[model samples]
Target: MAKQWLNKVLELGEVKGGLAWGRFLFDGNRWVTLMEQAPKGKLVGTDYHGNRYFENEGDIYTRKRFVIYAEKRTNAYNPTSVPPEWHAWLNYINDYEPTTFDYKPPVYALKAEVTATGTPKGAWADPDKRNWLKYSAWAPPSSGARGGKA
Candidate 1:
């Protein structure tokens, strides 16, 4: 019992040091979540996006699954950031590992919020809002304005 508490304390310290000050100090909800999940979970695999997946089966009924976000430690992490295959495993939709299936992610999966202001690049491209086709080239008045012969 003492060892578990010590381990939890150590893990909390590590998490506090590794992440940003805002995440450690302000995001108490995620801190509690990490505290709950860090002790017993076993790391299963890392996805292409750097997200970590963990599972714990302690002879209890249902196995527990957790994920560590690969993005910044801020609260900006979204469910869309998780890939489909990993999402299935995290939600217990499939017992088999995602690697067992030959699945391909769509083009949108590659899109990310490139700007610091939380605006997505490829996903936020709306033709109706900002249409590039509406722009036309500037043409000179005519030959008569320049005193050119007809």
Candidate 2:
């Protein structure tokens, strides 16, 4: 029993060491995001996407920049969520925030695949697959107008 306890204690110490050195991005799956505790940097500004940008000029050798997402669940956060301007700052592309730069988001053409029954369609369906005559919008010629013709 003593040996087992000692092993567990040693494992815990290793985990602590890894966290202190920033080896892992997560911190016990808490509500806080990883970037919130990223390098101790100054809060520069927030981007349009609500991502907070930070920069630390503490020392020439250790200067760093990071971002903490505003998403409630940070674990599912993706780096792509950061806009181009903030992305530039995070990557040190420019010394200043890309305020005046014009950024056009890429447009994507998306189409729905699921059928009315909620089952995913394995193959694409033809738009004109159904017969339209049965559901035609124009009403049949009036019998009186045609002198009671069929």
Candidate 3:
């Protein structure tokens, strides 16, 4: 009940002119409201996706570091949005936190996979011909480009 009231007050205060007050109030119990408790260690860093990571000595609630996924815009729950790096940190592959460590993502790994060009052709466009050559026909040469005789 108290937490709900605090959330409402924080929201109202934000709508008003007290921006910092609202932020502080909202951030004060963010871990509790979101993750249901204070983070065990320091908040290391936040990704572009808004997911925050934390780290501390191995203890209860976690054997190593752990992460909290960012709440959706509508505050709905979804776990698939968590990025890979934070996921590794959460699983305790490295002791150093993301904020302190120099993170270098693999060049190819960071690149997005692109699908093959062109949409699927409908029945009106062309019939499926498995053995047909897909190349386009070449245009006839222009007189100007060929330097033709006058």
Candidate 4:
């Protein structure tokens, strides 16, 4: 079991660099948890986005379910990134596996997913309420250029 899990980890951490892919990407706690908790869980299924779901029968309480998101390589996942069906299973909302069921999202839901992913939340869209500096090239003026002492 340990060897199989190690092989999976090696496969997961392998990248085009020919070295461990996620070593530099994930933080310390995340890396450790991935190495430890993973050994106890059985791979339940994988979602369309590549998120891997695991179930640990040994863990009767707390979270028996967990997910290794598709974006683990870049460590860029968030709760918002998971699809609704997968989210439901992860949170124990349902015991059913996501892809096994016949399900289709509403048209509006799909649109929202596409729009939200490439941009910020609509509530934070107003420029006056927040700065877009992080997502934009708009830099503040130099002190001298802005009429401050050089």
Q: Under the 3 Å rule for N, CA and C atoms, how many clashes does model 1 have? A: 0
lDDT of 3 at 137: 97
Clash count for each candidate, listed in order shown: 0, 0, 0, 0
- In order, the Cα lDDT scores of the candidates are 0.64, 0.51, 0.52, 0.64
**What tens digits encode model 4's per-residue C-alpha lDDT throughout 56-109?**
888765568887766543445556657788788888887887768765777777
TM-score of each: 0.55, 0.40, 0.42, 0.58
Q: Residue 48 CA error for candidate 1 (Å)?
A: 0.7
lDDT of 1 at 39: 68
* Model 1 residue 11 CA deviation in Å: 6.0
lDDT of 2: 0.51
lDDT of candidate 1 over 10-35, digit per residue (tens): 55434445446556557765666466
The list of candidate 1 runs beyond 4 A from truth reads 1-22, 59-63, 99-150
Clashing pairs in 1: none
Which structure is stronger by lDDT: 1 or 3? 1
Global CA lDDT computed for model 4 = 0.64
Which numbered prediction scores highest in TM-score against the true structure? 4
Q: 41-111, model 3: which lDDT tens digit per residue? A: 45578876666665555556454454555552222334555556566667666555566777787877763
Locate the minimum summed-lDDT window of 10 residues in model 4.
111-120
